[model samples]
Target: METEDEAVQLPFVGSFDRRDGADALADKIIRTLSFDLQDFRRGQRPGAPKGFAYLRERVEAAGIFVLLIGNLGSHHSALNVELFRGFALADPVAPFVVINDQDSDTAWSFTLLHELAHIFLGQTGVSGSKAGTPVEIFCNDVAGRVLLPAAELARQYDLRDAPQAEVISRIAAIAANRQVSNSMVAYKLFREGLISHEMWAAVTSLYRQQWLQNRNAARVKENDRGPSYYVVRRHRLGDRLLKLSRRMLTEGALSPSKAAAILGVKPSNVYALTETAA
Candidate 1:
């Protein structure tokens, strides 16, 4: 698409009345008459890739390109996975949603929608773990609502002030069903007033600690297994970029090195990466 006007307008955003502020606007978007999330497929993937893929496809279909990157070995310190999650650019000509692939796939579900929230608002900026600013919270609220609707949660779970054990159990079930993190579920509960701020804090803190520990173990296992380079490249580059790169390469419109630059891989790897967008 050459301009934002040329891109396909998402069906859900068409119903916006524009009478409310950001937070209220978010609620309106979620309640769109055309809004239905049943197509967000539920899969048995050990991670959350299945959910992320379905959502990403929908986003790209609406004329935005999604990119994925990782913590560059030693350069991991530079990105600081603890602080940075992802960012979006609401460019009039080429809107882009770039996410850190290094973040857990489950977390990707929340982060992807969060960035999408930015694009819908025509807000261009970075997003991080700490959602302090109004824009960040708005984005967060949109993501949470989409993934775990307040009505659904309240209807399905007790959501009342309860023993820590019961709260933990409730959060886990929702997180697993919604393909999001427990922290996200807790935030939704807090936003819905079903839980106190103190309870939200406790739940989020508990999960953050557990996630870090699990991540450390998974990292060790990954090192032992040594990931497949082509698989990683194919995943990060995504289907839209891979297909475009392949077509351009066949047409001789794009050089191998240029493809590498665009795909964030070496020239030799571009061929394999473009060969399969799975």
Candidate 2:
């Protein structure tokens, strides 16, 4: 539970109960900041860079923090609880912590964006009280509006007497288009009485089981590969920095050591950057 003063710091941004509502907050934030969300969704340069290091740089630049929340007993996993505490300690004012549920990219994306909405609303110190403090409730409402717009979702779901599978398919399609998860869409439908609670629960359970199975399979594959470090993406060094690096490399404005430091690498790795450019 949050104190009255703490609760007052949070702002309500958009509709949270409906399927399309959750995305509203993010949409509003993007627009307010004069940023095009499409720009963030684009592909990076091939073989440019990888790993969470790039992501961390982007988050720092954007004043956001992404925390990966994985299953218990998973080695090298990010713990959500620890992330929450860390963010609280690091930046008490407007700490932005995005949580990924480690279930699937879809779920992770949805939850991350939803949490981002909470940060945009200026809500902090939100404990896991599902009965949720007023501020939490308001944040949830904003998340709903941002993810599922009421009018838009209603129009899409208003087709004649759709079956559960059909409805789920449609919801899944919409979620995919919005870069969110289908379960989030179904949850919204159940909340709106578009789907029964039992149906929603059953679908959720199935997805959970599937996700667990896939994760186990992936673990086996990782074991087979031994210890191999994978670079996920590299363009995350900020567009400005990336351009500057390239220009400096051509004009000799940046030395190899300076370039390595800019990329968050040790001075010894300076050759790596030059080698890549070579």
Q: Highest lDDT: which candidate?
A: 1
lDDT of 1 by residue, 1-278 (tens): 22213455454432333335545655654453233466563743322376777777766666567888756644344465566788888765557888886666678878888887777677777788667887788778778877776678657544565987888888788777566777887888888888788888888888878887987897777654554777756667667778777877887778999989888778988787787543
Per-residue accuracy of model 2 over 235-255 as CA lDDT, tens digit each? 223343444455565666677
Give each model's whole-structure lDDT.
Answer: 0.71, 0.49
Q: Please list the residue runs of candidate 2 whose C-alpha ends up more than 4 Å from where it truly belongs after superposition.
A: 1-27, 33-61, 69-94, 126-137, 158-163, 223-278
Reference-based TM-score of each model: 0.82, 0.55
lDDT score, candidate 2: 0.49
Model 1 — which ten-residue stretch has the worst lDDT? 10-19
What does the lDDT read for residue 200 in candidate 2?
74
Error of 2 at 182 (Å): 1.1
Candidate 1: C-alpha RMSD to true structure equals 4.0
